[model samples]
Target: MAGTVRKKMSRFNSMISLDEVSRIVKAYSWKKLSTVEVETATSVGMIAANTVVATKDFPPNPRSLVDGYAIRSAETEGSSPADPSRFKIVGKSEAGKGFYSAVSGGESVEIYTGGILPEGLDAVVMAENATVSGDTITVSSSVKAWENVASRGEDLSAGTVLVSSGNIIKPWHLPALTDGGIDRLTVFSPMRVAVLNTGDELFPDAPDHIENSGMSSMMALLPWRFSNTLWIGQVHDDPDDIARAVKESSDRWDLAIITGGSSLGRKDEVPEAMGIAGAIEVFGGMRTKPGRTTSLYSLDGKPVLSLSGFPSTSILMADLIVEILLEAITGVSGYRIRERLPISSDITTGSGYTRLIPGTLVEMNGRTMVAPASSNRGMRLGSLLNSSGIIIVPEWVEGYHSGDLVEFRLW
Candidate 1:
């Protein structure tokens, strides 16, 4: 039965433009994943499930930005070194401890940085700008109203949204969330992915095969790149074995990635096996170099992408397709870092196909320029390591020349 299924699907090969494939993936109605509550410390890199609002004003009260004296601005008007104005220091305010008394005319409160400004005080005079003599502060410079005072709600007000739903939490966002009194956040549960390496030549225990296998590299990279990923082990070129693995993995994981057997050769049985496993072929091929054989499938609404066995091609195709799927599920764009840089040399491409080339940015003549690491070859592992990003050549454009600006998609 499996042999007949494989034979029928082998003849079902089709090709489509990359843009059309992207549009198709985007158009799918993806159900939102379940949510989980995590402590703010561990929430970095997770997508927020709900908007986080500030419960109270940041600084909560007017505070001093410098170690100085809090006084009414009118008292310091027209004061300078030549004609200093002296005011009695009636009290002192420190962080977490406030001066309960208000500042009256001709009186100031000695305050430190982050200290709450006493009542009736609208300005802070730097210590260097004033001379102190036993309970008296002499101001030599005029301070404008609200100067050096971090006003209440200046940083964030109550009910202000600190982070919107679907935003990927970053390290820098931690401080703001902590200050907003958010101890915990609701975030989408990390996607669970299963990688099934289909090939008779590969073995998990064999060092030589593992070193050369794209599956091995993916096992190490996927967890860091996305979320939880499990290596469900490898399979030979048997149609039944591949189909069984695909069905089992799809049933348990949010996504299943099958590496190898994605091309047109006789041994390439992944596309057929996927069909036998009840996966509808979303697309069989992409019009992109190094990864044109890349294919996508849907099993019970979950995604399963079949990638070429060639090492570099598998990695590049994953970057493109997996990122799109992740964005669809998590509502976060994959490329956190992208830049437009000048090409250091000319790159030619076929007019009908989109090309992706690995390259590294180099400093030339005091300007940052991108140098193509190597041609778009599937097995060029050296180029993959040396390159910091991929240089994309669109289908409409034939190529790019030296000094021409191009978009570089960072890894």
Candidate 2:
């Protein structure tokens, strides 16, 4: 049964580039995803299913930016310390309150910061620039129209797009959305994921129980509240047991992540189990170092990401690949924070494989730069701990010299 399964999935046995993986992922026919309406305040990390536009203008009315006297700009023209302008004080305006009467020629209204601009008032003169007495104020400086006041609809206009479709909601976006009168947002529904850890040595109750760091790290890196996952715990290296688990998970979860048994080792049974469970091959291998054995398969329309059993490799693959899979399934492209910085030292990579090197950002010579965290690319879990981001070297490039600018993706 294992041999037959291998033959069926062997067409993609050769290594493929990440570009090919992207093409295949984009071309896959996925089922229509449902959208949910969530409160704008709590929608951070959710993918926007539709564009959110402002319902009304922000700063609904013109308001005072500083505590000053609201007056006609023409009244203060040519006014200075030597030749001042005087006006009679009509009334005071506070925030959320406006003067009921309009300020005519030779009249001023005392207005505080954030107070609604009085009717017929087009400018404001700072209190320090005006001398106040009983019902009279003298202005020593000239004022311009609409100066020191927030104009209506200046911050955000009605019908302006607050959040575009296929964008992930962020915390900073909430304030603008609320100001734009958006109480709720339409976002893609959260996905259910099942994580399965394989290998006989992974038994937890036994004395030989190995810590499943791969499973723990994968779960931790996924965006909280977005990828709702159920840990299937550990399954032994038996093909039948693995196949049963895969089938059951595929039935219940939107996606499945199986760690271990992806390579051609003697104990590797995940490939055979996937075949038995009627999984179709999407890509067998990738041209990426440390995660070259990372393979993707599909059962029905759901995807399964088969990662290496090695803790470091699995964790890195999860950080990079899971996001792509989620975006593909939800039909929403999420944003990744990345920067291009010059390397502090030289580093070498083999040809024909894209390399992901963990690194830290350092300030040297008054400029921010990236320095390689570990020379060892395999089984270096400590590298991940000390690193702030990943340094990517594409397949076409052989290596990088010191001071060469490269793209870095923040974890």
lDDT per residue, candidate 1, 1-411, as tens digits?
Answer: 667556645553456777887888888866557789999988888888788998888988999999999999988889988988889999999898899886679999999999999988999999888888999988887889999999998998889898888788889889888888888999888777788887766865544454437766676655452378788878887778998987876656788888887766567687668768888877788778878778888888889888887788888888778778877777775344678999999888777778888989999999999998985444487888889888888878899989999888888
Please report, as a residue range, the 10-residue window in candidate 2 with the lowest summed lDDT.
4-13
Choose the strongest candidate by TM-score: 2
- Per-model C-alpha RMSD: 3.1, 2.6
For residues 382-410, write the lDDT of model 2, one tens digit per residue.
Answer: 88898988898999998899999998988
TM-score of the candidate numbered 1? 0.91
For each candidate, the alpha-carbon lDDT, in order, equals: 0.81, 0.83
Model 1: which residue pairs collide?
none
The CA-based lDDT of model 1 is what? 0.81
Q: TM-score of model 2 relative to the true fold?
A: 0.92
- Candidate 2 structure lDDT: 0.83
